[model samples]
Structures are given as C-alpha cells and as structure tokens.
Target: MTLEEQKEIQQLKQWLMQSQHQAVISGCNDILRRTREDMRVSQHILKEVLYLKAVAYRLLADVNSAIETLNELISYFPDYARAFQELGYCYLASDRKRAAHSFYQATRFNPALLTAWLQLEKMYKADNQSQALALCQQQIAFLTSLPRALLGATDLMHEGQLHKAEQVCRQFLASNEHHPEAMMLLAEIGIQLKVYSDAEFLLESCVTLYPDNDRAAAAYQNLLSKLGKFPDAVSVAKKRLQYAPESFTVKVGLAHALVGVGELEQAIDIYRELLSENEDRPAVWVALGHALKAKGDTREAVNAYERAIVFADDFGDAYWSLANTKTYRFSDELLAKMILLVDAEATKLDDEIHICFALGKGFEDSADPTRAFAYYERGNRRKKRTLQFDIAKTEKALQAQQQAFTKGCFNKTQGCQAADPIFIVGLPRAGSTLLEQILASHSQVDGTMELHDILGIASSLSHQATPYPLNVSALSNETLSKLGEQYLRQTRAYRQGAPFFIDKMPNNFIHIGLIKKILPNAKIIDARRNPMDCCFSGFKQLFGEGQEFSYSLNDIGRYYNAYEKLMDHWHSVLPGEILTVQHEEVLDDLEAQVKRILAFCGLTFEEACLAFHKTKRVIKTPSSEQVRQPIYKTGMGQWKPFESYLDELKDVLPARS
Candidate 1:
C-alpha cells in the first residue's frame, strides 16, 4: 500500500529470515492490530504476517500454538507450502505418524520441498518401508545435489531472480571453496545464463573434488549428455555402476546413457530389469514406457505408461506421457478421474497442469470443444504464471540474429565440408518430427533424436557478455570450423552406420545462421505449418522441458512471428540453402512431398520415404505418435474449434502465407 507499509513488511520478512522468531511474532501482531483498525493492509500481506507468526511460534518450540496458527493460516491459503511444512515439523515434535501425513501433505502441495523429502526418507526408513523409502530417495536426489546455501537459492532461481541466486551461491562458494554442491549450483546458474564453458568447468571440478557425491557425478554425466557427449556420458554411468552395482540410480543412469548412444534394446532391457526389481516405482515405469516406445513396441509402451498410472495416479508425467501418444484415447472413466484430480487443490501444481492438459485432449476427443477449450486455457494460464519468458528479450535476441548474420558475415567464414547433418528446424508442433521421420527412412539417413548439439553450440557461443548471435560476430574462421567439427564429433554416438543423420531440433530455427556458418554444406529443412494449428497445438501440449514460449497465447504468437521473420531472413540471405516443407502440403499429397524432400536432400526417391509411417524409431517430441501414422488432413484445421478463445493470438499472427 504505502511506502512506509512496504518498508515495514520488508523489515518483518528480514527479521523472520534472520530467525528473530519472538521479535517477528510480536512485531507482526502489532501490525495486525493497527491494520485491523486502519483497514489498509491487503489480505495477502495479512496472510504472510500470520504465516511468519506461525513460523516464529514453531521455532520457539510452542508446537500447539504453531499448529493452531498454521491451521488458521492454511484455512485462508490452503496451497501455502511453507505453512504445510511447518505443520509437519510441529506434528513431528509430538507424534511421528501424524507428522508423516503432514509431511506428505507438504510434499503433495509442493514437490520441491526438500526438508519434507528428507523427513519422509527418514520416516520411511524407520518403518522399513522400502517402496516409500525409494520414492523419497528420488525426491531427495535434487535436495542432496546442492549445498545448503544453493538449496536456499533454488527458489530464487526458479522465480527468475538469476543474478540474485548466482550472487548468493557465489558468496557461499567464496568461503567454502571446495563445496561441490555450491559449485554444481553455480554450474546450473551458468546453464540458465547460457554460459556452457563455465557450467562445464564447475561440474567437472565438482566431480573431481567430491568423487563420492553421486548427484554431482550424475550432474556431470547429465551435462555431458546434454552436450551430445553420449559416449562420455555412457562411460561416466558405467564407471559409477562398477562401484555401486546395486545402486538403482546408477542403473537408471546407465540405461539413459545407453539410450543416448542409440542402444535402445539394451536400454529397454535395463529398464525392464529395474521394473522387475521394484514394480512400485512409477518413475521406472515411465522410463520403461519411453524405452519401449523408442524401440517401436507401442503396445508395451502404452502398457508401461498405464502401469505407471496405476502405481501413482497423481503423477503428472505418467498422464502426460499417455497424452503425448496422440493415438491413445482416454477412457470416459479416466477422463472423469482426471477432471476430479485437476480440480483438487491438494494435487501438486506440476501434476495438476498435466492432468488439465490431458483432460483437454480427452474432452476434444469426446467432441466437447467448449470443455476442451476451458481446460486448455486453464492449463496454459496456470503454467504461464510459473514461467519467466520475457517477450522483449526474445525479440531482441531474434533481431540480433537477423542483424549479425548478413550475407557478408557468412561469406567471411567457411565451415567444414561435412554434409552429414540434415537439420529440421522450426517451431514446436509444426511437423518437424514428421519431416525428420520421412528423411530418416531414407537408406542413407540415420534418424537420431532431436539432438541438442546446435543448442549446445549456441550456449557455448553465448559465454561472452552478449547472448548468442551477437557473440557470433567476434568468432573467427578457426572457431567456426572448430564448432562445426565439435558438432559432428559430439553427435557421433547417436548415429548408426549411415553416412547422413537427421537432427530434428525444432528450436534450431533461431540458430540457422550459426548452422550455416559452421556447417555450410549441411542440409536445412524448415518445417512450416498453419500458424493457428501450430500455435494452438503447442498451447495444448505440455512439454517435459524447454519451449517456454508455448505457455501463453500471446507468447506463442510472438514466438511464431519472430520465427517467421527469421526464416524469411534466412531465405533471403541464403537463397537455395534451405528447403521449406509445408505440413499441409505433405498431408495433401504425401508421395509428392516425400519425393520433393528427397530430391532436395540429394537422395533418390525410395518407397520407404513414402511409407515413413512404418519406419519405426524413437520419437521424443509431442508429435511422436502422429509421425508413426500415415498422413491425414484432419489436423489441418483442428484449431477452428478453439478459435473463439484465440482472438488475442489471432491479433498477433500475420496473414496466412
């Protein structure tokens, strides 16, 4: 409200943070009394004041008083995670059994509660509950991966306060120089800031300093995998397994590494074994589903996903996995259950978002567009609140790419002559995966996952003061060729024995200039779709990672416009260097479009390309199931049913090309 009132709130928060519990309780009570008479304080501020009072009571060992205060606080704010956690602490001080339930509630509302995870882990271990203990371990992995200081910083990082989090983490590491968790946290911050070299160094040093920290080692291995160092990742996983053969975490790591190296059958075998050992592990079931789906066993994959749902009905990933199948229709009973869960306040936000999107698909399939649009909008709105995607920053970055990658810029530097890479780049849900499938079906083209080599290169390039394309201007010819070589070497593990490979990373549309400069002879395919259909499809899908722009209709439209303008620029400056594959054209005439794509890639027409639907492979994108089926025109205007809710998006889109 007033500046003085704001200052008072900040002072109260600072006192509470500093553990002046009694002082905070007294101060907050005085404010509450004055605000009650003045009627100036907001409800949210009042709630926070009460919450701090409850925390202070709990810290002072007044368990009953804390419980009463927390109950009152939660009556008004049922979704407050910290209040729930404090309730757990108070109950634990009295009765362990009740504490366990309270802790469960805390974690149920906020899965990121590290303290609750650790408490659950201890409670389960004491009760000799192996399955529950294992689940707790999974949750604790994230908490144990970071030091206390970094753990405290994660909230700030997630809130998009990156610089503040980085400063806090760095300050901790300054004194505790050898803290691996703090180093790893800094590495994570570096990644968020798009500085790959710094992140890599921090992770490597973390592993070197603390070899026994499996989480740090795993983080290092994961960083390697993200950078397309599949062979190195496999080596790291295997090394860990050699020491702790019984560690399920290491076994899972090995399985993931095997998948990265294109050992799909072996990965499936490992996942199956893990499931045999612990059938109650929902995460393992989800992993099995992914491996089976990648291996082209659609029936088994669906069964695995269903098994996960049976084990943990509230797990959002399981429901989203089933929805991502595209071909799987939710039963009427399942739809009703999902609707109930989506409406439940106790359901975790992540799980609720997944259930909402799944319900949207379910309603759409049942021909209930009104309900479907409501669910879709609800899910998108919920997710948009959690994201920190800045429209201005995205626009500026895209504009920098256009300005930096002029014809003269590319002509000044030449890349390697390696033409093995065939990139399918465009917005998500734009049929990029389908185009990749057709190309991968060719005898000479090995279909790989949406490899992150280009993004990794872009991140490495963005290590300077400026981001991405702006930093590209300072790179020399030697650096460009080296980057091209690095991409080829890093991606080697994903390839079979084929001479060419497909990298179907959709967001690579932003890095077309970098792609051209580093690998001048590489083939580039721009997968184009109807703007309404593509953006609407993305709005409905819940991606496991990345694609922050799809969470809101305005952001989605802004991204699509930026993508369209960038693609137009690429076409203008690099004429005849890129092929545009329109999704509607393929649906209209599959054979003709397939032949045209083959001709552009310098490959002869083959029946396999026309029958790409039958060429089964591991498809990781949202369009995974769609690409496994023959072309159809039904998806062309699927956005029409939801057009009434898309006026804001329509206002931002250009006229249909």
Candidate 2:
C-alpha cells in the first residue's frame, strides 16, 4: 500500500477502537474503493481493510453485514484466524455449534488464539464434553505458562510475520539469555530464512546446555538431516531415543535417519514394527515405499505405494512416488482417480502440485503430449509461486565464480592429494547418475548417493566474510588440505572399502572451484545432455528437495546457461582437469564412453562397467529404474513433442552446439 493508504488504515483502526463504528466502516469502504483496481495494493493491506470493516459492522449491530464482510474476507484469505474468531463471536448467541466449529478452526490455524481456546473450553464444559474440556484446559495452561514475549513471538510467527517474530525473539533473548524456548524460536526463524549455519549453532548450543530438552534435540536432528549430515543426524536420533525409548515419533525419526545413512534393512524393520503397532498411517507407508525403492525392490515398493493410496486416495506423494519410479505406468482407473483429486477444492496446494506432475507423467506414458504438457505447465507454475528462486541472483553467483577462480588461484594452492573421490557434477536429469552407475560397476569403485559434504563445506565458507569461490583464493594450503580431509572423513560412512568412490551430486557443478582447491587430486566429470531434453525432463520431475531452479522453465534454462558458462570458464583455466561426458555420445557407444570415463579416473577398463545395468547396487535417484536396464534411445529427443510449448525455455537456453 502507498503511505497515504497505510495512514488511512491506521485511522480506521483508531476509529474502530474509539467506537466510531460508522466512521470506521465508511473510511474502510472508501479505501477499498480507491485501491480495488490498484495491482500495487498488497494482500496484507486488503485483508486489514476488510477485517476492519467487518469489526466496525459487528460493533454497529449489523450482524448480517458483518457476516457478509467476513465471508468476503475469508474468500481471499481463508486461513485468516482472526476472521474465523470474529465469525465465532457473531454466531455465539444464535448458533452454538457453528460458534464452536469456528472457534476450533481459529485455534487450528493459530494456536496462540487464547480467547478462542477459552471459549471452546467454556462451551465444552457446558456440553459435558469432559475430554475436549480437558484438552482445551491443557492447551490454555501450556500457552499461559510461556513468557509473554515468547508467546507474542509465537503468535507473530504463526501469522507469517517472521521478521517481527525474530525481532521479538532476539529482544527476549537479549534479556533472558540461554532461555531454551527463546533460542529454539530464534533458530526456527533462522531455518525459515535459510541461514542454516546460524540455526545449527543456536540449536546445538540449546541442546548442549539443556540436554533434557527433547524439543531442542528434535529440532537439531531435523536440521542435521536437512543438511545431509546423516551420520550426525543418526547420532542425535539415537540420543533422543535414549531419552524417550518408547516414543513413536522419535523411533520414526531414527528410522528416517537410518535410511539416510544407507542402513536400509534396519530402517525397513523399524518401519514395519511401527506399522504393526499403528497400521493406518499413510505417511509411514510412503516412507517405507521410498526405502524399498532405494533397496532395489521395485515391485514391493509399488505395492507399498498402492497401499498408501488405498488408505488415503488423496495422498499425492504416494501417487507421485509411483510416477517418479520412471518405470511405473498408471492404469486408466488410477489416472481417473488422480484427476478427481486434482480437481478437488479441499486438496492442499502441495498435494495438488504432486498430483499434477504425476498426471503429467501418466498422460505422457499414454502418448498424450498435449495433455501431459498442460499438467506439467500447471504444476510448474504452481510450484514456482511457492518457491523463492531468482535466476538473476544465480547468474550473478556463477559470474562471481568465473571472476574469482582464475589460473593464478589454482597455481598457489597445494590441495590434499587423495584420489579417492570422483566428482560427477551437472544439472539434474542430465545422466550424471548413469555415469555414476557405470563407474560404480567397476570392482574398485564405490558408488555413494549424492553426498552433501562438499556442499556443506561450501555453505560454511559462504557464511564467512569472504564467501565461497572468492574465499577459496584466500585459504592457506594447510586449510585446503584439512578441508579436503574433512570431506573424506565425512563421506567415509557412505563408502565400503573402495579405492575410489563417486560423489554424484549434480548441483556440485557450482562448487567445482571449492572441490579443486580442497581435493585437487579428485577427478571431475561434467555430465552433459541436450538442453531441450534435460530442461524439459527437469520441468516434469518433482524433486524431494533443493533444485529450486527446476520448478520453472525459464529458471532452468537460465540456470543451464549459467552452468555452461561457468563450466567453460573452468575448462579455460584448468585445461585437462575435468572431463565432459555427453549423454548422447554415451548412448551412441556405451562401451567407448565407459572406457573413456574409466581412463580419465585413472582406472583400467572393466567388463563390469559395460554391463552397468546388471550391477545390483542400490540406486536412489529417479533414474534408478531406467539405469537398471540396458541402454535405450527412447529418452533421446523426448522434448520434441512438447517443443511448441517450450519457447520460453528455448529463448533463454544457450544455442545447441
């Protein structure tokens, strides 16, 4: 809103407080009329004006008008807790059931609504609902026990005023330093802001100082898992289990951590045991499906996913999991059911996006490219709205890396001489995993899941004043060696006594400079694919996490452009230090490309590498199923059918070489 509009809103609120009901209503209506056509007016400003108008109508005894105003407000902001609370007040005298339901919804969205809880408690007591009354009392007591500042911060956080909440939390911590709850709240804010290092430090300190604080420990474990520190996450989960041996949530968390650490068997056992105790949990079924898929049990994984859908047909993740297998084809009946769910108004945004992608895949398999592209575009558009990707920021960061990592920078550093790691770096869906599979089939090579240790190291350095690619030029030789050693030590858990192991993180393309400075002996492979095929494939896929650039066609195109520019810079500065493996070239002659890859990594050619599809190691990527079979030319030029709709992507991508 403009400054004058904001000032007018303040005046409306003041009039409402002074019981000038008619004046407040008239003023709000005027503001709404003036800004109705203004696209610049924010949703926040509109919500404030409508809410104020509703309050004024309520005070003026215009019950019908008040309800109408609130209903209108809710149409735009359905999750507005205060509007629901006000509706509860409007219905309190004439409709007890509606009032109770409205109050319940208010608290459901924002648990800090004390008045709603109090009203619910009173109503439940009057209705002789002993269980509900007791629950209400419990919530009220817990909320009342919190410090006032912390409570206000919690409320603000729930209302999406994260910066204001962070300010309140910091102020509270300023006076009440070491307060576990305050520290945890601030850490949560940090996590939401994507400041992982600060969040980790705060949570770690909170858990260290308050060992008995299970909440802090749980939060710390979650952050560790998010950062892909699976070993550390597993340790934290075990400690939490020690504290709460019988806790179902903690057990489930430990199982997830075990899965992350590649202890699939143990994780599956825990999941089964949990299901035996509580068989109706669809989320558990989905998690079990993922573990089974990673364990190379595709048939059993499909069954597990189907079971989840049987329980909750609207469960989009389960359906998406089935599609993500890249081998599963949806039946007409299943596609119809997914279509219904996608059209359902009650389906959540997350579930809708997943189902859209699944439906896109389903249609694509059925040879309906037009319909498939429609759903893919729908999913990408919706997903992009939810993400905070900035193509310009990404381009600038790559450009900075180009400017920072020069030939002279590499000349001064003596990095760790360990030749254990072979880094596979590129955009997602670009056959990096295929290369990893080929190399991993060799007897001397161990294939690990996309390890995040290098990214973690880069993240830590980015938090330093100098930041990543630039920071590399400032590191001493000893520091570089230690950083390399730290990566090896961290990734050792994923290795099984191989002379060489593969770290096939595709986005690690952006961190080649860091890898060079730390592990100078490490072999780097740039997995390349046709721009159209790779970008379109990424647009169709729904990643579990990260790869935010893939949600939009334009973003993915620009990202690929930046990636190519940076890779060109790398080649120019460090000639013969990196190998580029084109997917099409590998498709034309798998054996020849496999020999070239093995040779680059200083390994002798092996027959097993040629028969990579027959290798029985666990594969975790979406290409897991496709890679298990012999080479096929079907994936080549798959984007041609959707070419008419890909002009935006084509406009930004580098011209075909």
Candidate 3:
C-alpha cells in the first residue's frame, strides 16, 4: 500500500478504537471505494480495512452489516482468522451454533487465537461437549503458558509478518537459549526464509536436547524430508514411531520417509496395514497409490487413486495423481465432478491448484488445447502467488560459479577420482530421468532416485563465511577428496551393488563445478531439450518441492537461459568433462543415443539398455509412466498447441534456430 493509503487505514483504526463507529464505517467505505480499482492496494491492507469496518458495524448494533462485511472479507482472504472471529461475535446472540462454528473455524486457521479458544470453551461447556471442551481447555492452557513475547511472535508469524516474528523469537531466545519451543519457532521462521541449514541445525538441537518432545522431532524430520535427506528422515520417523507406537500420523510419516528412501515395499505394507484398520482415509489411499505407482503397478495404483476419490470425492491430489500416471483417463462423470470441486468456494487453495493442473492434463488429453491452456495458466498463476522466485538471484549465483571455477582453479588441485557416480543434470522435464532409465538398464549401472547428497554438501558449505561455489576454490586437495568420499558414503543407502550409480538430481546442473572439484571422474550428463518444450513442460508440472521458478513462465525462461550459460562455463573451464544429451535426438533414434550415452560413460554396449522400457524398477518423477513404455514422439512439439498463450515465455527465451 502507498503511504497515503496506510495513513488512511491508521486513521480508520483510531476511529474504531475511539468508538466513533459511524465515522469508522464511513472512513473504511471511502478507503475501499478509492482503492477498489487500484491494483497497488495489497490484500493485507484491504483485509485490515474490511475487518475494521466489520468491528465498527458490530459495535453499532448493525449485526447484519457486520456479518456481510466479514463474509466479504473472507471471500477475498479465505484464511483471515480475525474475520471469522468477528463473524462469531456477530452471530453469538442470534445463532449460538453458527457462532460456535465460526469460532471453531477461526481457531482452525490460527490456533493462537486465544479469544476464539476461550469462547469455544464456554460454548462446548454449555453444550456438554466433553471432548471439544477438553481440547479447547488444552489449547487455552498452552496459549496462556507461553511468554508474552512468544505469543506476540506466534501472532505475527500467523499474520505473515515473518521478519517481525523472527525478531521477536530471536529476542526471546537471546536469554533463554535452550528453550525448545522458542528454537522451534525460530526454526520455522528460518524454513520460511529458505534458510534450510540453519533451520535444520535449530531443530536438530531441539530434538537432541529434548528427544521426548514429539513436536520437535516431527519438525526436524519434516525439515530433513524437505532438504531431501530421506535416510535421516527415516531415522527421525522411526524414533518418533518408537515414542508413539500406535500413532497413525507418525506411522504415515514414517511410511512417507520410507517411500522417499526407495523402500517401496515397506511403505506399501504400512499403507495396507493402516488401510485395513481404517478404510476411509483418502490421503492414506493416495499415499498407497504413489507407492504402487513407483513400484510399477500401474493398474493397482489407479485402483487406489480411484478409491481415494470414492472415499473423499473432493480429494484433488488423488485426481492429480491419476493424471500424473499419464495413462489414466478421467471419465466424463469424474471430470464433471472435478470441475465442480475446482469451482467450489469450500475447495482449498491446495486442492484447487492440483485440480487445475489435473484438469489441464485432462483437457490436453481430450485435444482441447484452449481449455487445457486455461487451466494450466490458472494453476500456474495461483501457485506463483504462494512462492518467492527471484530470477536475478539465480543469475547472480550462476555468474558467481562461472567466476569461481576458472580453468586455473581445477589445475591447482586433484580430486578423489571416484568413477562410481554418473550425474544426470539439467532443468527438470528435460528427459534426465529417461536418460537414467536407459543407463540403469545396463548391467553395470544402478539408477538411484534423484540423490540429494551433492545438494546437501553444497548446503553444508553454504554455511561458511565465503559459501559454496566461491568457497570451493579455497578447499585443499585432501579436503576435496574427503568431500567426494563423504558424498559416496552419504548416498550409499540408495545404491544396491552396482559399480556405477546415477544421481539424477536435475538441479545439480547448478553445482557442476562442485561435482568436478570433489569427484573428478564422476560423469556429468547435461540433459538438453528444446527451450520451448522444456520451459512449457516445467510450467505445467507441480513439483512436490523446490522448483519455484517453474510456476512462472518468465522465471522458468530466465532460469533456462542462466542454466545454459552456466553449463557453457562448465564446458569451457573443464573441457570434455561433461556430455550433453538432447532429448529430441534420443527420440529420433533411441538405440544410437543409448549407445552414445554408454560410450560417454565408458560402459560397453548392452542389450538391456535397448529394452529399457521392459526394465522393472521403482521410478519416481512425473515421467515415470512415460519412461516405462516404449519411446514415443507425441511428447515432442507439445508446446505448439499452447503457443498462443506463451508470449511471456517467448519474450524472455532466446529466439530458437
């Protein structure tokens, strides 16, 4: 909001506080009218104005107007907990049940709303709801137990004032350094700020100092999973499970970690056992479907996904999972139902996003490009709002890598010379997984899921004063070799017995120099695709995590350009150290490209590589189903159908030859 607008809001708040109800309502309406068409007005400002207006109306005994204003505020900002709380007050006299429901929803979005909890406690007591009253009392007790500063920090965090929240948390932690809850709160703030290493350290310390604290353990485990440290996540999950042997949530979490570590059979067994006890959980069914799909059981996966929708018709991830299979066809009835759910007011933003993408795929399959592009754009736009992607930061990082890793730097040091790791790196949706599949088909190669060890190493180095890429040049030769050995040891859990294993972390393209510095003999394959195809494919995909740039066409285009520039720098600094594999070329002649990849990897020709489609292995990534079948030409030129809607992307991308 502008300075003038902020001043106006402040004045309105003062009026409301001074009991000038009419003046407050008039001021709010005036502000709203002036800024109704102003795109510069932030959602936060608008929400504040509307909430003030509602409070003023309630104080003036204009309950209907108050309710109307609160509903309007909620329509724009669905998760506005304060608006719901105000609505509860507006309805308390006329409809006690609805008042209680509104208060319940207020606490649901934000558990720190002490007033809502107190009100719920009274209503639950009056209604003789023993279970709800007990829960309400517990929440009230917890909130009352927290220090004033911590409570303020919790409120600030919930209100999206993350920096303020961080300040308050740090202040509280300054004197009480070992306070677990304070550490957890700071860790949460760190996670929001994308400081994963710091968050990990805080949570790890919290859990270590207080191993019995379930919340601390769970947060640590979740952060580990977010950082793609699945083995560590598995350990944490197992620890939690030991603490709460019958806790379904902990068991489900453990199963998810198991899936991440490629223990598909164990994850599947756990899902089945959980489902046998309770067959109505839609999320569990979806989890089961993912494991089944990864294990190469497409039909059973489809059945599981269908069962999730059967149990909860509005479960959007289940529908998206079915579409993600790339083989399941949504029937007319199901498609209609999905349309209704996507348009429904009660459908959550998370669900709406999944449904939008799913609908895009569904329409694309039906050959309705116009409808497909519409849903794709809707999903991308919605997803983009929830992310923070700065292309300039990406460009600067890539440039730093270029400057740090000059040819002279590599000549100064010798690496570990580990030939076991063959890294397939590039932008996602660029056929790296396909390359991994073909290579893993060879008798000598093991295909691991997109391994995170290299990224973890980079993250650890990022905590140093100089940080990674820049700091890489300062490492001694012995340290480099030790780092290389560390990587192999860390990734060992994902490997079986093959002499060579593939780490198909596409984002590893950013760390080519680090890869070379550590493991000089590790083969790096740059998976290339047509710029238009790759960017569009990425734009359409809803990755589980860490591809924030893909949600916007301009961001994705700039990212691809930066990636190309960085890859060129890697090639220049370390000549012949990396190989480029074009996805289209592979499509044109699978056998020849397969042979070329094998030759580059120093592997002999193998018939199994030719028959990669028949290889039965657990596959992750969106292209799992596609790679499991014979090579097809349909995926090529897919962007052409949506060409008209890609002007923003085209403007940012270099002109194609």
Candidate 3: stretches off by over 4 Å: 1-16, 19-109, 116-138
Ranked by TM-score, the better of candidates 1 and 2 is 2
Give, for candidate 3, the lowest lDDT window spanning 10 residues. Answer: 409-418
The collision pairs in model 1 are none
Residue pairs in collision within model 2: none
TM-score of 3: 0.89
lDDT of each: 0.84, 0.89, 0.89
Query: Which consecutive 10 residues in model 1 have the weakest lDDT in total?
Result: 152-161
lDDT tens digits by residue: candidate 2, 26-65: 8888878866877667777888999999988988889889
Relative to the unseen true structure, what is the C-alpha lDDT of residue 12 in candidate 2, on a scale of 0 to 100?
Answer: 89
TM-score of each: 0.83, 0.87, 0.89
**Count of residue pairs whose backbone atoms collide, per candidate:** 0, 0, 0
- Model 3, span 1-657: residue lDDT tens: 679777988898888788999999998888788668786677678889899999999999999999999988876676678888999999999999889888987887778899999999999999999998998999999999999899889888876788999999999999998898899999998888777788999999999999999999999998888877899999999999999999999999999999999999999999999999999999999999999999999999999999998998888899899999988888778778888999985576778889999999999998899998999988888777655566789899889889888988875248787799999999999999899999999889999898878887887788788977789999999899999999999888888899999999999999988988899889999999999999999998988888899998899999999999999899999899899999999999998999899999999999999889999888988899999988898999899988888999999974861
- Using TM-score, rank the candidates from best to worst: 3, 2, 1
Pairs in steric clash, model 3: none
Each candidate: RMSD: 5.4, 3.9, 3.4
